[model samples]
Target: MACGALLASACAGMPDSGDVEAVKASNAGDSQVRVYAVAPRDNADPEEIVDGFLEAMTSDDPGFATARKYLTKRAAQSWKPEQSITVLTNAPHRGQADRPGDPDNEGRTFPLTGRRIAQVDVRHAYRPEVPSAFDTGIHVVQQPVGDGKTKEWRIDSLPPGLVLGEADFLRNYRAVNKYYFASDENWVVADPVYIRQRQDPVTRMDPVTQTVKALLEGPTKWLGPAVDSRFPSGTELARDVRSLAPDDQSKLRIPLNGKADRVSGVVCKGMAAQLLFTLGDLTSVRVEQVEILGSGGTSLCLLTKGQAEQEYSPVREPGRGENPYFVDDRQRLMTLEAGGRQPDKPAGVPGPFGKGTVQLGPVAVNRTEDRAAAVLDNGHELRVGSLTSDEELPEAVVTSVAPRLEDRLSAPSWDGRGDLWVADRNPVKPRLWLVPGGQGERVEVGTPWLRDGTRIESLRVSADGVRIALLVTRDDRTTLQIGRVGRGVVDGHEEITVKDLQDAAPRLESVTAVSWAGPSRLVVVGTEAGGVQQVRYVQTDGSTSATSVLPGLNGVTSVAAPYADQSAPVVADSGNDGVVRLVPGANWQPVAKGGRVPVYPG
Candidate 1:
């Protein structure tokens, strides 16, 4: 089919013979700009064939049938566009191959080159890498037509998967969170993956169905070791089901194969919770309840949103209406209502730290808002104390010997599991420590990736405890990275490690601060190469959209976001303004003078 058949609006202004003018269109920074691919024309040359094929891969065409039209019969049959995807910083540049083709001159080769930035594996997991070179060759040969007289140039040998620019990838695909139970915990952990923005051609499934399929396929490799799927092995959707839609009552009915037919009601409820959470990102559809059916067409179990929330709650959802906390100029801990137009004056908590007895540098309040952990006395010592009573500061739980305050211990963070995490940036011996339940003996978490002058500048543990966000610095450049938190027993001893580190804000040249804003989203403070500092939100998968950038602020030193409520204002410590916040639909407003390290309960 021609481009007009797919998108009449895009092709409506095209010319038949005269020169064409390029006109720019904007989506106002929210919606995606759709691109319809044009099929190969008759008597096209090698360059045209390759260009058309690349463009076709970026379209929403069902089955990618048009892209195959540019390839030879054998190549088309062997090509696997679904295998993987290579994302480039920009469109690939096509040129002559460095080496000549075969001596018989049966084919010509063209090099498709670009600066590779990331790759998506067969499981639809996006892995961002340091900028690197990407070079591949497409071979075209002259083939006879049906009558065996006219010769036409067609691609005979090419790369197996698709190659797309970053812009095109964002337009054609979307990042979604698939849910799985945390190992040994009932709460669901978000494992992010990329899926087609529209229907998946290969499976003939809509976005909702595609998410269900990914969930059943299991978690991504990085998170697989830390989470578990409730679905039994070999469990899958019914063979005949292609798409999923919610009925009038906003209840979705799912049909599973026989592998799930024998599951108990409790296990089935767990499966339903996973499905409901996995399908939460499909904003276009409303699903309040989920019903699971056996392959024999019998209802196995049904779960409503309320029941799921009561039985298997999400890790980061803390209900709502939590207050924000910060350290005032007097070196005291204070609090103010979040999402308030004119909240009451910040009030000091009932503790020695709030009484200005012990100076506090950076502080983190526990999820219950009853206790606080802080780097005390010039960032050399860490302490945890209650917030409801004026208690004396306890002995330091963790201390750093780094001579300079800047090289001492970082701010402490609390996970949903009630564990405390902090990074010691000592030049001689740097380490990441986890104090179980905030009072147990501290254990040094293993991080084999920090080496050769590379050190962690700051860190934040996700509320789920399955992931940690780190601001790592090397040779004066700081980058934001997200690593998986793996816990297990080894040699009759408990072991905790952070592994599979990948860039979470690859576009930023340096990151100063970061905090988990939601289950799979974060608010970051950083600057692009040669650009001014800006605050933005980025997903755990390292994906950022145009709307991710927040309103402008000057001299931002640190940023904090509430994990439970995204509607609440984003608080930050500014160099010019002591403390500031960005409220919904408003610009930055002053919250406190000389307030530093504002934070919300993790």
Candidate 2:
């Protein structure tokens, strides 16, 4: 069968391509882009054939037809790449085994093995399960022709999927979050999307340019309808964009086509926000300002990341409408003033959770610090009430959920819009719940990333409501994963779901907690392979920095970072050393003794 015939056979009875709406965006321009792969040569050994095949897989070729050249005609036709793609964490190992082949006995059988990063299914969903499950074998055959003196080793048998080393994979694959507005315009969600670029991400200007290109191409097919963009339809960068760019000052100049020529200033800034948030995420580029240009390279407006945050008003700001609050050992909910580091006395504490019989389970304050949600009876029931200073207490309990002690609710997190989000750790009924601010409507949001048997230990929605941090425990290992939130109309109603889930802290074996330290940084408390507990600062893309995670935070039970920027890290000592905080270039300062689980408003 022909190559097209083989692929056609796979999708034989599926919906029409136009109606299916599953077209994938291509990364190639008119010029071919090669990603460091040499063509195969005659008389190649089985190992060389295998190495060449793996290298060809890294090419940005559509359907990897170039990679199949190393395989025998029969094997290439039989290969079904749509089955699955195993992303390797390291380079694959190649070895030969005794088998019948050439006179030298070196062109017959081979095996490949590696530690995988993830497995992406046919529908493009990423699965981060047992990464060491792949160990494949390949058989090679020599194509007899002309004189038998020249032997050519071609793969006769191999398994599905592509394998690449960590370095190459990092160079080829880049993650960018496409910005979309929540049902409430006040909030914008970042939908994480991975795109391939012909040029390396380390190259100057390429990272930002390619990222902005991907953003303009629009969200992936699966997530398109769930989000919206400010960039007009068919918007693209002008052919000659560099002439307008200010490379010295790390400025990005994007000249869109005519589709977005006359967009309002608000729309242009929102477009800039999307680009700034997306490009600023690149490990290689530091985007200070984005200049939105129109046709003919005419400048429309200029915006900075800080200005974007203000104009969009997406992220929740700490100390804006929030006051300090904590639960004491006596089950009292204490409040602290703006400058005071310690809470008030138990007698001076406020709220019903302090006076009621509910034992004061894990508590979370709203974005405004005027409402509190607490779990009761070891996580069976949850209730919400007003936190106003002079308001009348609820006559009785306000709202409650299914009561079961075996499964509990993780700490609740509130978004900037005053909506509360909580996860039920119930294995039988595991779910994430969202309670709208005023109406108090509880809705169950679907999170496919929350695989079965995986328990969500902690969940925190970013102040901007675009990203979420989760501590998931599975198979006795805890890891931190972040996903972009996508909200849109579904079944004629507003629905929010988490998409593009990726592990943010893959090196950590046991993660106890996670908190957003900055717009793109996460402060995590976890342990490495040796089981030595420590705190780490990591980016949303899993990259680490020296100053991201503060030092001297060991034996820290709970950790908290301000929503805006790095301040003194407030920590709860694990060994009763008292609640201490670390200041850069200084010593640890004690905040309050015996405090755990420090948190900001949202």
Candidates in order, TM-scores: namely: 0.93, 0.68
Off by over 4 Å in 1: 1-34, 96-104, 314-317, 339-341
User: How many pairs of residues collide in each model?
Assistant: 0, 0
- State residue 440's C-alpha deviation in candidate 2, in Å: 3.2
Per-residue alpha-carbon lDDT of candidate 1 for residues 1-602, written as tens digits (9 for 90 to 100): 23443321122122333333221211112234444556666778777777777767766667878788888888889889899998888767778644445576867789988898888998899987677899888999877877989878888998768887787788668888998998989888888899988788677788888899999999988889999999999999999788899999999999999999999998999999999988877888989999999999899999998777666765434465777899998989999877566563687798777888788889999887889999986988999999998777788889999999988999899988899999999878889999998888999999998788888988888877899999999888899999999999999978999998889888788898998998899999998989999999998888778789999988888888877666778889998688888877989989897898989886
Whole-model lDDT per candidate: 0.83, 0.63
Checking candidate 1 for backbone clashes, the offending pairs are none
Tell me the lDDT of model 1 at 286: 89
lDDT of 2 at 49: 71
Angstrom error at residue 272, model 2:
2.3
Q: Give candidate 2's error at residue 126 in angstroms.
A: 7.5
Query: How high is the lDDT of residue 430 in model 1?
Result: 88
